[model samples]
Target: MESSLLLIQLLNGLQLGILLFLLSAGLTLTFGIMDFVNLAHGSLYMLGAFLCASLTLYSGSFVLAVLLALPLTALAGFALEKIVVRHLYERNHLDHVLATFGLILCLDTLAHLIWGPAGIAIPLPDTLNGQVELLTGVVVPTFRLLIIGTGLLAALGLYLLVNHTRIGMLIRAGASNRTMVGALGVDISTLFSGVFALGAALAGLAGMLVAPIAEASIGMGNDIIITTFVVIIIGGIGSMKGAFLAALLIGLIDTLGRSFLDDLFKLLMSTEAAETAAPAVSAMLVYLLMAAVLAVRPQGLFPPLSR
Candidate 1:
């Protein structure tokens, strides 16, 4: 039973890691290249889940809702960049933080007005609603496995887009030195806008995937965005490789810590004391991990080559 529980927790961690990767992939790109601090990124995530929920109900197919919501989320991000984000780009990081926080409030209020204050639950098709046993005794949800699969495919696609394509070359160049890329006639503004939209889409994808389990509601992105920041920070601000691995590491540590920390503590101390301390320590595990990482490698585990 313990082994089975461990396997299940492992899968849970992977699912969460994949979701974080989806979010941090875009965020790291935007942060690395555009140097923009977007506190409202979670708003995009919330929007994606709500959009998927609405579309799923309207279209009667979970898959189709995802397809439809993705582009719409991207468009929303594009419009946001052109209208509001672009204006703040020239400002300092503090201004970026303040403005984006305001944007978060605005976006959350808008979501509340449109989707109502209640959380919206997403439905899955039969194929994705069942459970499967990957190991002798460990059963996992089909939807969670699908999320992991989709996130892996997305990571691969992003890898190809960033490393192999011409646009990717331009992206790297811009990240290293935007002024030089702009001087070379690369149309930096448009590139950054596209990057921002891509980030939004990735964030939205995370939301859509999570909604079936967590539901879609106003300010849904608020808490997760903090974790997302930790991911990018631990992975390195501009490093996709860092983001991917760090997210997985953090996810595993978080899940396993929350699941079994008390047991480990009980081995060391009394059961009551262990129970009292476990929850608080488990909650701090990620931050503690972050602090440890900073102490050892301030630049992160895998900083971008340019950095």
Candidate 2:
């Protein structure tokens, strides 16, 4: 029974890790390449979920809603870059932070105005509403499996884009040296806008995909944004490979810790003590890990090359 439970928890961790990756990949890319501090990126994610939910309801088709939401989210991202973000690029990090923070407030207010203060629940398609059995009769939700699959696919695509494509090369170059890339005749402004849009699109997709399982709520992005920051920090900022690995590691650690920490504590302490301590301790695991990483490797697990 214990082993079976452990397996289920591990699967849960994998699912969570993949979702984090989907959200963190774009964040790392945008920050790494454009050197933009976009706290409002999470708003893009919220927008995706809200748009998907609304469109799904209006169109009466889950697939159609998702397909439509992607482009819309990308366009929103582009407009944001053109209108708000471009001005901040020449400013200092503090200014960028302040501007993006303000944007988050505005986006949240707009979302509430459009979608209402109460959160909306995204209904899963009937086909993905149930569980599927894995080996040894362990069952997991189909929606979770779908999230994991989509996240992994996104990571793979991102890996290829960054390491193989022309724009990706420019992005990496920009990350290492923006002035040099600009001097080399690459259109830096266009590149930044493109990367920002791409990041927003990825965040949107994550929001849309996870909405059915997690539920869409006001300030939902706040929690995930923090998690995404931890993922990127632990994985090494600007390193997609690091983000992928760190995201999975954090996910597994968090999920398994939440599921089994009480049992582990019970082995060493009274039941009541274990119960009281388990939640607090489990919640601290990721932050503790982050602190440990920062203490030992301030540059992150896989620091990008400095130009």
Candidate 3:
């Protein structure tokens, strides 16, 4: 019974990690390549979830909503870059933070105005609402398995896009030296827009996938975005590979710790004491890991080769 329960928790952790990777990948990429500190990235994620939820409700089709939301999210991202983010690119990080923070406030206000103050629940599609039996007497949700697959596929697609494509080469060059890349007759502005849009799309994808599982709510972005930051920091600020691995590590640690820490503590201490300490310890695991990593390497688990 314990072993089967452990397996389920492990899969849950993997699903969470995958979602974090989806969100963190874009953040690390945008920050790494453009040096743009977008506090509003989470706002974009919230908007994506709202859009998807609304679309699914109205259209009565989750697939259609997802297909539509991706392009819409990308377009919204492009517009944001072209209008507001472009001006902040030449500014300092502090300036970037301030501007984007204001944007976040604006987005939250707009979301409340549009969607009201309540959270919306996205129903799982009929096909994905079932469970899959993995081993004898061990069952996992189909949607969670899909999430794991989606995350792996997104990681692979991102790898190919960044490494095997022309724009990707430009992204690499830009990360190393933006001025030189621009001097080589490359249109840096257009490239930045593309990168930003792509990042937004990835965040949106993460938001959409999570909506059915965890209901879409205002300020949800702010909550999860902090964890995503932890993932990127632990993984490496600008390394997608680092983000992927770090997210999985953090996710598994968090999930499993929350599940079993009290049990471990119970063996060593009184039941009441274990209960009191478990939640705090579980919450601190990621930050503790981050601090330890920084104390040793200081550059994260896998710092980008370029930056």
CA-lDDT, candidates in order: 0.94, 0.89, 0.91
* Residue clash pairs of candidate 2: none
TM-score for each candidate, following the candidate numbering: 0.98, 0.97, 0.98
RMSD of each candidate?
A: 0.9, 1.2, 1.0
Candidate 1 deviation (Cα RMSD): 0.9
The candidate that wins on TM-score is 1
Name model 2 segments beyond 4 Å from true.
Answer: none
Candidate 1 overall lDDT versus native: 0.94
Model 3 error, position 99 (Å): 1.1
Compared with the true structure, model 3 gives a TM-score of 0.98
Q: Show pairs that collide, candidate 3.
A: none
- Window of ten residues with lowest summed lDDT in model 1: 23-32
Q: Against the hidden true structure, what lDDT does model 2 obtain?
A: 0.89
Candidate 2 matches the true fold with a TM-score of 0.97
lDDT of 2 by residue, 97-127 (tens): 8999999999999999999999888877789
